[model samples]
Target: MFTYDTTRATAEAFAVAAPIDAPVSRGRRRIRELCADCVRIVLADLLLVLYRLRTVGLENIPTEGGALVIHNHVSVVDWLFVFVACPRVPRFVMHYRDYDRPGFRWLFDAFGVIPIAPKKEDPELLARADRAIDEALAAGDLVVICPEGTMTPDGELSPFREGATRIARRCNVPVVPVVLVGLWGSIFSRKNGSPLSSLPRAGRAQVSIVAGPPVAPGRVSTAYLVEMVTLLRGRHR
Candidate 1:
């Protein structure tokens, strides 16, 4: 089952801050950004209607400024859920393979998702991703990353990778932990077999998304994130 955080610290940590720095010049660049926001608004509305999504701790998310939004990966559409719940349109860090997929390449391109690969496979690409993340954060853009790196084979939360922590430390940004529950057994999840092979289960699935307090860059770690996410997921029998 999923759980919510109601502590005073969590509440105080997310007190709204002033808007992020908007240094973009007027003209094509500004117009493009506005168009993207419009698309996200439409998509978020559609998702809420289709899945009946429920979100908690939205106030825990800072309204503006740079943040490393971290979440446990469960379904292929997990990012979509997080995007809908967030106050800002975050640039997601995606696996290069997923970003290169023919069918979805356009979407990734349009959203400016950062594509990253394993260091061993492509050190250059990894370096580029790091630089991109740093630049985005400096520009006051929230960046979303799935710490698990890949989807979970089962419903259990996997150990988070170090990338999220490293990025937060490098960029000096708060690491916000968000968890998506009730996604297992869905068509986008690897419940019965390969994901997407089976038809969607009947009825609108009830999904609970909880956002935890932002962990400071110095205090964030893989183990800490794992524990926080596990607590958020709670005991599912």
Candidate 2:
């Protein structure tokens, strides 16, 4: 059987990087959850076969309760790694442009994804999307958002927006900061100005998903999150 180790050293480093002490809620899920246990296992195995996949601090993901997950965006496939590693199937807050793309709606719909567009594009649409996110959080669902808004054109982390902070504050939920390592030169990343411009790595490329303990809603901020993700990523591009 193929397996991976989540060493205590890694967990400790992540904890010290972002000190956190928040209550975990274990409540019955009120909304439909996607990615059943079996599906997650299968996807994880597939990822393992495709890359040198390593994860740390998954336990930081609350077993039950509404929480906001913030992560640095590197590639188009960043969500796949987060989905398989999280303890629960999280409702992804994705860009409407990507979520509404043809051939992807089926998958996004299955997970009850909340799609948001620029307020200038359609104020009503944005309002509805916000309402949907609120309802999902109230139902004790985990929601993941990339505050950078889009995948990075360069390997460096982009300036984070206030969306995550707003959600965590309004919903009164913990904010879990996550970082992805070693996805910079991937085919899906904008490594050379545009995605697919660069060739993919041969064999299994080393990748890591480091998830830190949840930050209290009161402590969540754009600058704080940027610092936490930067500390966790630590020299990895």
Candidate 3:
């Protein structure tokens, strides 16, 4: 929905305002120190029971260090699948509206999710998100972003946004591109109609997550990320 210029311009402005060397807040720093294994285990098990999840190339996720994770936006539960598949608990950049959801407010806060508004709508929120992402990476934490900006209206990939690439380039971190398969028809997805409007499919859905090796910051771009994700999705298609 956002034009390339708007997204890139906001990101560029944020990069200028918030240098990569900026310090992280004490509260944020302390939260990142705590292990989220318990939460991760609980959510991963729940998803496993509900959907037949298959993962490949998880080894590509670095055991330690700051890295940028870029993935396709498919379903509302896509982040859950990503959390389950990754070795570390990643701090995600989520929409501010989702963060304001009544029931999930605590979850997002506890997990240190960064809330962002679209650049065109609220450049201030986007600036804060960019700073948060830069600080998190500077603190040597894993950060995940869905460059498609929102879930797909159709079951096909959307053009990538420059925000993710901008963050990676500014922080000089590796970007890992991942693709999720077989979630398009699920109740959580915008498939067949409005999400949650139709009854959930009868049986457990089969899902797969494929990850490609990390792309260096210098080499990573929106176009390259789109190409990699398209190829990965093609494997399952």
* Best candidate (score: lDDT): 3
Ranking the candidates on TM-score from highest down gives 3, 1, 2
Off by over 4 Å in 2: 1-38, 235-237
Residue range with the least summed lDDT across 10 consecutive positions in model 3: 1-10
Query: Which residue pairs of candidate 1 clash?
Result: none
* TM-score-best of 2 and 3: 3
Q: What clash pairs does model 2 have?
A: none
Expressed as tens digits, the lDDT of each residue in 9-46 for candidate 2 is: 12222111100111222321211231234345667789
Report lDDT (CA) for all predictions: 0.76, 0.77, 0.78
Off by over 4 Å in 3: 1-35
Displacement of the residue 60 alpha carbon in candidate 3, Å: 0.6
Sort the predicted structures by lDDT, highest score first: 3, 2, 1
Please report the TM-score between candidate 1 and the true structure: 0.85
lDDT of 1 at 109: 54
- The CA lDDT at 207 in model 2 is 87
Backbone atom clashes (below 3 Å) for every candidate: 0, 0, 0
In model 3, the clashing pairs are: none
